[model samples]
Target chain A: MNNIKELLKEQIKFTDGYLDKYLAEKDNPQNIIYKAMRYSVFAGGKRLRPILMMNTCKMCGGDVNEVIPFACALEMIHTYSLIHDDLPAMDNDDLRRGMPTSHIKFGEATAILAGDALLNKAFEVVSQYNGNNPQRAIKAMNMLAVSSGTEGMIGGQIVDMESEGKDITLDELKYLHLNKTGAIIRSACTVGALMGGASDGEIKAVDEFAQNLGVAFQIQDDILDVTGDEKELGKPIGSDAEENKNTYVKLVGLEKSKELAKEYSEKAKKSLEMFGEKAEFLINLTDYLIDRKF
Target chain B: MNNIKELLKEQIKFTDGYLDKYLAEKDNPQNIIYKAMRYSVFAGGKRLRPILMMNTCKMCGGDVNEVIPFACALEMIHTYSLIHDDLPAMDNDDLRRGMPTSHIKFGEATAILAGDALLNKAFEVVSQYNGNNPQRAIKAMNMLAVSSGTEGMIGGQIVDMESEGKDITLDELKYLHLNKTGAIIRSACTVGALMGGASDGEIKAVDEFAQNLGVAFQIQDDILDVTGDEKELGKPIGSDAEENKNTYVKLVGLEKSKELAKEYSEKAKKSLEMFGEKAEFLINLTDYLIDRKF
Candidate 1:
């Protein structure tokens, strides 16, 4: 597609409208936590996870509404992570999406509580998804929990933090990145596959598709750190490089890293070949995710 | 009645043992988030909330084992709240329960993720309720969510923070406290009633019992600040006073606050009057709550 910017902009519009609708805002609100939660959730992003889930589910012939709650839950979980990560004790980010971070806009206590509220609310939102496929819904929830919980993103975050300034093996870095970023991305596709009622074989294919796409996406992020602009990226470019992070780029030279990303992207595309030419969105997404600069 | 401390000690021991088993420790595990989660969860505490749930359930003829998961879920939720509260952007507390807080022990990133994991794990734990009461289980889950989420504790925390240095009306103060402290306490009893398979009327009674108890317990905390020792309280006794918090003792004099607490404690006991002698543990717990030094 020649209009990637326009498509990305439209997707962000959907994210804004849908998230605002789901998280109703009120004036003269009694609680500060609710206000802070609304602030972080609406703080704005491209809604990448939700878009991937919706596009993937649509490719598998599922209605978007059926997957909307889980889509929103993914965003909520992501937002909660950002809000918490921006706290002074963590990454200490002052600006997010070119505005004050949650801890900057709201006080630190309110920001922390807001993150907590969003986190608890994500499960509540997912649990409300009671369609004819109750078992699948439960399975999707279980997958979401495992990917988002201690064994996944949280685990990876700890490894990343602990490994900072200290030398770590390439294997350790890969494991950390896979769990931190890879697990949820893969889960998003698997969730969409299950939501669309994919056959067992198709479900397995979708899992591989997403897993490869996630690795490729992360490697692309490593590439971006070396070759990105602050304006395009919407945050400081090469921040990771400055931090001496054990990124894919750091472990392998630039040439090898690019080759690895290309290999993973091709693998991701091949996984969807089982669905034949019908999986247009999945195919384009795999290309778009790795090729995009920001 | 003097043996109540012995009972509390015994209950604390059992809760610590059970909770410790679930948060199994490892030596510098592969997953940083998992290790951080275990670190914060197994950090010793009084285990007051879960004990309240189990003891209340037991008083209502429910086997403690059947309710243990939900009981642990309460503690998980509590632990999450504490971790978030200890974040540098939150309460910024370095110590809790006479030990380093979660954010202090683990870095802020891991601490945040640990709290996030614990909160999700709490909901997953609800799936373990073996009481064969799906409706009750769903209801309990909803109650736990609403009380701990944006509508309850988070809401209360917001107003409490915003009300800092500003004069809040008595009505505002009451509403804040009700949502902040009362909601979860009320839900704890309701969860206990659900596990015990109480009749509708019995559940109603337990909720009322908890509401009264919550108000009384909060008032007692307000009083303890003015008249408590550091060793007995295990914290700076007058921190609330130092913070100039709008506590019951601040709004009304100490004598009147004590009277209000005593009045509520009496009403709390009367709410359980319907269960007659079968609710002895609850009655004693209510007495202990309102009269305890810490």
Candidate 2:
């Protein structure tokens, strides 16, 4: 814990190895989509969701290896969502994490298919989980599926699309972010809780913790879009405003948005009071998430 | 049974009822994607995949009702694939089943989200199957996920995209169809067998039956594209040629393609000899599939 950055780096490296195992290079006839999918998945991210899941499971006294496949699946789903969000029909972003977007590298059609394949493969990987608790594995898979489906991520996406360039209520904006980003993040925690065999009370506590953290994470993102350096952020700032998308920073002034993020982060940290010192990593992670320069 | 057409109609009706039950209209915030999903699913192209699943389950002495949720999930996945395939960057077809394509009916972004939602929801539905055999349900769900994933349908699709306007060999064409159209259709049967508590041997036989039927089904589609009437087919005739796609008809002459379909159909029927008269409906369905004018 002396060097949180080093700890995060180690977690990412471990997750990358697991992901590489799941997405090994193939030379089959249909290797094009696999290659494209592997490209986006291996395109570096913080692996925040998966690291959180594995850490939460470990904190709950569950064997981390049992949840490794599921953690990898979560990362794949996140990567696929990013790939789809960058499509020409969606946000149409050309760059992600300082690299060409999936549609920018592969053609749009192949990119779309690659995203589809990754999403399908996420479920395939989770369904193959041979952990000691089959029931909990199914439950974790179910939570992940619902969190990323129409009622969750996709639902939020459609609303975001419909609300683009149009004025939306603060509640509407919150609803959009809650589904588009919050649901999957929340699912990451809940699935980990289930896999870790957490007590019902602990599971509920983690859910609340994850939900608040997820919303706070998005608010920090909004803040970063205004204050983040392009070199560090790896993408242009002010694109959200340019796109006329409603965000916390746009709805409230920067100062008020920062205050809101702090409040949510505090609430996220407070939700872990049930775990005492065992929640140190999660509590520190929330602060780092909010205070990061990028 | 008398009138295989009537039997097919009854099966479609049953599957439709089950689908409607699963896809109940919701007034939630993300209702837009749900509406788009329901529209494509109900657009109707003969509930062939779901029917094959249900029939396969019944033929193996399993209760059809036990696999209803999964059968509906199969249709949802099939409908989602069609929606994505009809996008502007893909086949760019405006009409499917005589109705405007999903992206035409809904905007492109919403259509894409709708397809993503459907795919996710398919897994959610199957994962919620509280049937008598939880282990089998997980296995069936895994099979469906894998079958429609990069190694299966999407794999076929990427190759199909790359092969466009290129002169591909007959073997290449078969590989594409075996994945693109063949995988899910085959999954419908394999999943059914797994759910129906079939023996390993029985499941293998049904898998072989489905593989043959899926290929034959695609060959019939090729034949229909070249020789069938648009009024009966719903979609335009010669559209495959219009797209410069390599099809069975394009590689082999129409007569040869038709003969190949017949050969596969006979093989499909022969594979079902293991089930004796219990597979009557499936056997008749194979003939109907090959002999279908629409």
Candidate 3:
């Protein structure tokens, strides 16, 4: 567990550097929005998405440098979503990662533009990848755009917002989680595999691994919302219930949700059997993510 | 003027069909956001950006069919910007194109998400374009992303928001309008030329033409707000002053603003002189856009 923690910290630092290099505030004359973007991005995120992408790339024996732009792009997309999600018209949250949310620090309009800028910059960063495999880069970019769009994250957001304080079916809940969180996670692994030149079968396996891991990750989030410590979690606990959001914990109870999370985690781990020792880090990372309290 | 109006009406109808095909509501399981996206997109927009792109492509001897997806993507991006700009936190606009603005027709959250979806989907549509020149498509996408991002439209929006009700220099006003309106308009021309396989020199000329046209178009907008009829304009006039926005008319007075607009329009038309008769439609379109009542 400690080894996994060390790896996670190291990867986070590396991704932070890449993010700063790509989106440094000095390059932009419109400094305030850039500053706001940097604020949320450098706000001590776990860097789980980029790290997952990097590790999957490594597992497939690909050069990490080639995919760093794409990896950083995923993180930017994630950060933008968080900024918008915390807006007054959305979740209306005040704190994120133990710091003032973007809107709380900057004004709402600046925050909104910051989010928009980050999303646009994410595509800009990937589009600048003049790699040996421009075709692969274009493919990865297309998948990233699709996963972050209406059929994916934004679509899930609409459903989630509409379902608030209302009865939602288990299938509806699954649909929301799959698109909201699952889509990007799946894209992260798939892009990593594509950058690494993985075969179709191998890419399919990575997709399966990420799909289960994404659901398990959300289930853990639900569990933590019910039982997390605010000091460790950064934000306050019980926000999910306060928002009247449907969750795995809400539908299946704590113990059953825990069991389900474990099931999904196991499924994710099993998906790595084809990679054998090369996927050891991924297998351990799954356990670590499922065991996370924050 | 009547001939240009007929051409404009024909172009709008063509773009409307393309928008409907690309963003049809029935295609997505998340039906509400899709419906919201379609509503604002079909809200009687002038289709200026896409029409500019298509016409430039035609002037470059490029197949309009090959660039229609890119043309439509530009419109989607334009629509998304308008949707977000109309948010209560931003402009708080109640009406657009004589219809209720996005947030008025849909709820604020849905409107925001719909804007986000449209932005992402714009890139998706362009990415799926299987043109003969993949490199050109990628280059055009990069330019599109940059123009619509921090250094372009969003950047302009930030300054405009911050400068409201405050004394601003003509240079600052120029900078604001350049980014807020100029970036996308210039991109529409540049991308069209790129898709049409224009030479570097030709692309440069188109860029200059578009830049002058963009500034002229904005000045015309300012002039219209001060003096044009509300009925023909669809929305009420003089809302710029009500919003305390700084405009060319505010800085230079209506007569000077009109003269400046004419100067830019002439410059834009002159840039296309190298194309001889091939530029006839573009020259006429430039005049029509600058002389628009709506």
Candidate 4:
């Protein structure tokens, strides 16, 4: 709804469609699982996470072009999660962005293998990155591992699955949302800071901003499930209610959840205060996360 | 058998559960997937593959302890594949080494998640080896990525699933088996060479040894399916035959499969000629892979 459209355009322009040319080499790099991996990775999404990462880097004095592979790597990890989460054994959703999900189009085995390949390749891409400092690469890689591994998003998923259709405390719900959604969001910011060679204090501020923003993002999703238009959301409205999922609105009232989301959005914006006027995009993004219909 | 057992003992001693204190802090690392991952990885097994790696590194003039993490990493990948392969949707097995399969012991969801965690953690372990020679670490990591990714083992898995109960050419069968079994086996040897600073000639020889040895290993399993005693094998004999799976003995006669195994065994031994007597452990390991009953 703002200047992000242009930024998104520039980022997605560089991200999509090029992978196939690389895959179409004389050696037939375009193998079946690679095709499946590439299909989901290149599938048309907003590329919001990568754009946020790149723009944040540029704002903090890093070359966005130099960080392109990492941006692609983040997209790869994000896409891998979507692929796995759509498996029959996992989230089991058949539709994504109005097209059949990866498992639905490719067989289940290929879908599983595609996720596996993407995850392995992500580290490969990051390893290829000879950043200005090796220690920073090590820290960034460690951040990614924790964010994606059992201790972070995966841990959150396990707890969420166990809590489904059951009463969960607000504390547990917050922990789940923070680890599940906030972990990656925070990781994207941390990656930007590392690439940009930010000071430790600046990195801490970014982490706080991301964490607050992530809560608002999930809270907005809860609001959307109850109020959003199906066509706009591209899925069933009230589906969360139907699933009996433990959510912000379910635990607290809808009014309270909305208030909480606003509180988080404000705190997110507050974390960007030190950047003065250069943090407009982040501030706007925080507001947009809680304000959007979907 | 005479010298190999002694070497196995020596190699195992080099690893010596020495990381117990550091890993203990991280061990049972507080999440279901983390706990399950440790259970699958650190739980007692033959340690045969890691031992092979250690001995090969020693034979090539590398520090055995320096390569220990890679040795552990290789086993993690192997364990992960085994765990996933036994899932209900995959091999659907219930027993491994006379114990419940990973999917049977943990629920399918946890089993799947556990495998996913281990695979991710394997790369995490490898990426941490940023020694003085970052280039060697990079080369080793890239080799690992290719060997483990879509173009290698997972591709084989996809083809193996698609071709189950279908007729296939011998070349196709070899391709499938080579990738499914041979890729990591080849990796085990090459990783050792990479650690040891082996010449290209040395690396090539070890690679040849690994490939032929891989064929022998798979052929031995095929032979064991029909001829091995159940007691020794710790499971039902003739299992592959009962599944109507395509195996070497099924395509060619039993005698020919045995002859092929012998030929491959000879080739493997000859590949080690450059290293002369120093490769005795690897030579013995090759013999053990082709000649063992279970």
Best-fitting candidate, measured by DockQ? 2
- In candidate 1, stretches whose alpha carbon ends up further than 4 angstroms from where it belongs are A2-15, A27-32, A58-62, A129-135, A199-201, B2-10, B26-44, B56-63, B107-109, B127-136
- Model 1 vs. true fold: TM: 0.91
iRMS per model, in Å, is 2.9, 1.1, 1.2, 2.7
CA RMSD, predictions in order: 2.9, 1.4, 1.4, 2.7
What C-alpha lDDT, on a 0 to 100 scale, does residue B270 get in candidate 2? 95
Reference contacts recovered by each candidate, as fractions? 0.51, 0.80, 0.72, 0.41
lDDT, candidate 1, equals 0.79
Q: In candidate 4 chain B, where is summed lDDT lowest over 10 consecutive residues? A: B21-30
TM-score of each: 0.91, 0.98, 0.97, 0.92
| Candidate numbers sorted by DockQ from highest down | 2, 3, 4, 1
lDDT of 1 at A129: 54
Ranked by lDDT, the better of candidates 2 and 3 is 3
lDDT of 3 by residue, B180-206 (tens): 999999999999998998999999999
Q: Candidate 3, after superposition: displacement of residue B178 in Å?
A: 0.9
How big is the positional error of residue B108 in model 1, measured in Å on the Cα after superposition?
4.0
Taking candidate 2, what TM-score does its chain B reach relative to the real chain B?
Answer: 0.97
- The CA lDDT of each predicted structure is 0.79, 0.88, 0.89, 0.77
TM-score of chain B of 4: 0.93
Model 4, B8-84: lDDT tens digits are 67666655474242123343223566666766666556676677677778888888766777777777777888887
Worst 10 residues of 4 chain A by lDDT: A21-30
DockQ of each: 0.46, 0.80, 0.73, 0.47
